[model samples]
Target: MGPIRPTIADVARAAGVSRTTVSHALNGIGKVDPRTRERVVQAAAELGYRPSLRAQRLRSGQSRTIGLVSSMPVAVAGGPSKLGFFMEVAAAAAETAMLSGFALVVVPPLDTDPPLDALDIDGAIVIEPDQDDPTTKRLQSRGVPIVTIGPQQGMDLPHVDLRAPRVGRLLLEHLREQGARRIALLMGSGHRSWYVDLAEVYARFAREHDMPPLVVEADESGGEETGREACAELLEKHPDVDAICAAVDAFALGAVRAVAERGLRIPDDVRVATRYDGVRARTSTPTLTAVDLNLAQAAASAVELLLANLKGTEVPQVISNPDPRLVVRESTRRG
Candidate 1:
């Protein structure tokens, strides 16, 4: 027979704390003193004690399972930067959930009306939902927990969103500093918050600088063809434009093609940059400078927030992601 496993009581005794205190610390009930939580964690680790799944389920009436569902189609291979983002986020979420004795399921968008029958999850994280997103409504109607990566237009659920407006201003400011006088924006056609946020920032910057807002919208997921077509048109209309800000790496790569076809040297005749950073951007010609959204952190935070919600704990209505780093590469480095 297997040796007996340590229980929460054993951990509590080792840490010199009550079972209630141990439970609160282990379950992230919040308001526990930092030193106390650390001691409880150390004691639990030393004793190799994990909360029993059967007991936890019976007590909480939950499966201790979490779901991660992205609005964009996620792929393991042969997709764009956004797909890469989804996979990385999923990996992080799974790790975070497992540490808390929860199983993480990567769920695709549901086709039928009722999706709960498919799986019993305590909560889910939806990435980049639209205004009044139907998915959230349907899930809420069935009493499923949801935490979106980006905010829905009017939904009142907890969400974790990036500082998009700040990122937009930072990008424009970077381009302007690079001697890009006649800069053009390659934006997305979607009405998502990030897109709207960037457009508003671009318009405002144009107004303040007294320069025409050279903007063109494209299918963000159209890969190179969409970017190429959009860039070609932008160039055709504003031939003398000195810089282009592609919305994603796909568009940035296409812009590279379009610029080359017109005998333009990137960062010379025309500088280019993109929003999402990925392998494609790093490997592209003149390597596109892009935004590192810190998707992994965002994903982990979403899982934690959902856990808090499930526990009926009080958390902020809106959680803003505090980390976004800009990686400037060869594409926009004018030297």
Candidate 2:
């Protein structure tokens, strides 16, 4: 090496400040006087000091890395159509993390116990955690800062989630407005909180309207095939069913195929809607009437909340209730 690189200590000495003050000013971690911070920054720039990521992590006790964990197991499947919504959320989170100077790692769900110790993450963003999930439990036990995409069962962690119940109600009301007297719900077998909310709302709305509650369960993890099979079964059993509300776009796409195979006209013979809107919904034949979850905003909020928690700021128990936008399409438009 021709010349040794300048270090934080050298900058600190040049600025006549302690090493800790230099760190705070450079990282914007702790509170430092404005003049002192400016002096430290100017000295570091003049000295050409570039702090090492590893050394800063060691000093701050933070890995400067966050993890994106999902209970859905969508990443391993390589099925982009089935995981469009989640993939978008992950993409947004990754972009936000990068801008905030944090590296984002996607962690697969553990079949066995979660190896929390093996992950060198400062915190995690869990997507749609279920009740009593081992991963969530392990992270909680370790005192890890966690932000969930949806409300976690029995945990009061900060969460950024779409209003599932409201979305369900909106879909139901729209179907009824379109002259659908017999509406059926297609849902996943998993008991995630969002699923529960959707199911409960659908049932309650049906009861309130004096309509028969028809609910069908499908292998949510099985993607489009399961959705198609579930829709076929629903139609075969209830030929009078005029509307179908699927919890995901994959399921809605399946329903569209099922309807076409049955020689039924969309929005006339049958109407279809999905709770989660994604690329599949927008590109499907007749397109899909679905709810836009505003995944980008939710991802950004989750990253911001996690960053705040990491900075030792007191974050209130956040249950973000963002308004869901209903996108109308040919599938649900009558007249």
Candidate 3:
């Protein structure tokens, strides 16, 4: 019905080289001479030749493929989860995997068992697993070499995470230095490592300071709405609150709006700070102060660690990124 497409054999013949040589040149595999590779490429172009990706994948199997999965659901049409942090992490991980010469397939969170066999993956990087995660269980049962982006409470696995205690201290200290007397925290009710570690540090800080801790926990996934409600509740209970440290950027941004709705000026009436230097934090009114967790670096590290695990080489059980810097902005500063 249509013109017969050219094949590798045709390109090889036209280039006056073996099929193996053509494969090497096309795939950028082994050491092929620069001139020879050029010639082969030219031949393929002239002959309108294309190699079958399916065939190449069948031959390589899981040897050249890896998987990236999230414990949270990602939009089917888009790769990112509800949280922008996860989206940034996934993008960084994909780039790292490409540079490492491996194909990465992102699998969305599902309640049923993942189709691991059908996926053809040698190893996997879990974005952030829960304390009792079924996906983690399935991967472990299948003996998949696994690494995690965020650490968990119970599961022991290779992971890369921020030092939350150190990060928390920096935020609190910044607020206090700005003359905040009664500070409150707005956070998620989740038990993920990030939230858990922050809560621990907050508790310790409260005990040491001999000040009563004020924390408001809610479903942070609702982004600004959750922050608004949580901040409103906190303010109603503690009207003397002079500072707020929100763990999520959306929460911090919403807190800014909430303060304004109540005719309060940020940094003057209520200083505001949060974690994760994303668009919401940077672009919010007064631009909320936030901690730069080095999201891209952390995500890339997860891929590299997973790559090491796939190579059967021993890697450190845990890799913690150091000194997540705090980015100060108008929300926590006096004009």
Candidate 4:
């Protein structure tokens, strides 16, 4: 060999510290005195020493990698304005992971059990896991730490979630307050916890109020087109629905289109509201009344909870219950 690369031991020697101290200072792990850590860092910089990731992992038995899996395919989640919330949440999670010295790998939805052996990850974050999700089951069977972005039905994994039932109630109550006696709900056709919770709460609210409960389900993967079609069908069939609560912004935007096509005026003819606030909600014909789910905060909390679990800390079953903010706009305004 022409030249031997400087190692942690060499840096420790130059800094007059132990090899463990040097390791902690370089990796920002463990507790090292501030002055001593500074000296070790400076020595390592001067020596041009780079620690081997493989060696460190061997010592700690951790891959320092995280997997982010979605029940929906990445392509489907990344498609259009309707699925934009997933992208925003993923971006925030990725940033938080990087700050905590971990790499986040976005894995596409698996048709069958995931091959856990192929992934070198210490933990995983599952988004919108359906009941008995195969990927989640495989990861759990492998004894990997997992945190979900939303509650996973039939799984007791820690999660960071918006209060879906509360959001549904809030939207329905707001519509009722806006003088909508005959209201309809447009929701996704999925068994995901959020969808189930929203549907349950909506039905309960409609029953308590003694208003005829009307619901239309649509394929969320089809984006705005699906919402438009669902809303059109609901209006053509119900004809008397005075208000509509879309479980997502995509559906709300589509409902706006359907209303326009029927030559109806928003708020005056039929009010509309959405569960998740986004760009589409803001720029729609009559800016949508929506519940801001605070996705960024939820995303950050999910990563933090996953990191806590990876660090051998006891994570609570529910790390966060994101409060929904109701934003009233032209869509629900009354003259």
Candidate 4 clashing pairs, residues 3+ apart or interchain: none
Q: lDDT for model 1, on a 0 to 1 scale?
A: 0.81
Residues 74-181 of candidate 4 have per-residue lDDT tens digits of 333544443466667778889999999999887754445456669989999888887856778788878888999889988788998778888888888999999999
Show the lowest summed lDDT stretch of 10 residues, model 4: 73-82
Per-residue CA lDDT of candidate 2, range 208-304, in tens?
A: 9899999998886677888899999999999999999998677888889998899999989999998777778788899899988888999989999
Q: State the TM-score for model 1.
A: 0.77
Model 1, range 1-335, lDDT digits (tens) per residue? Answer: 99799988899999999999999999999588999999999999999899998887878789899888766522211354444656778888999999988899986533333354576788888877767457777778778989988777667778888778877887888888899889899876667777778889999999988889888877755667788999998888788899998766677888999999989899888988877787777889889888888878888888889998999999885788876778899988987
Model 3 TM-score, 2 decimals: 0.78
- Give lDDT tens digits, candidate 3, residues 260-320: 8888899899999998787677778898899888888888888889888877778887888
**Candidate 1: where is the Cα deviation over 4 Å?**
1-60, 73-83, 108-117
Runs in model 2 with CA error above 4 Å? 1-51, 75-78, 81-83, 108-117
In terms of lDDT, model 4 sits at: 0.84
Q: Give the least accurate 10-residue stretch of model 1, judged by summed lDDT.
A: 73-82
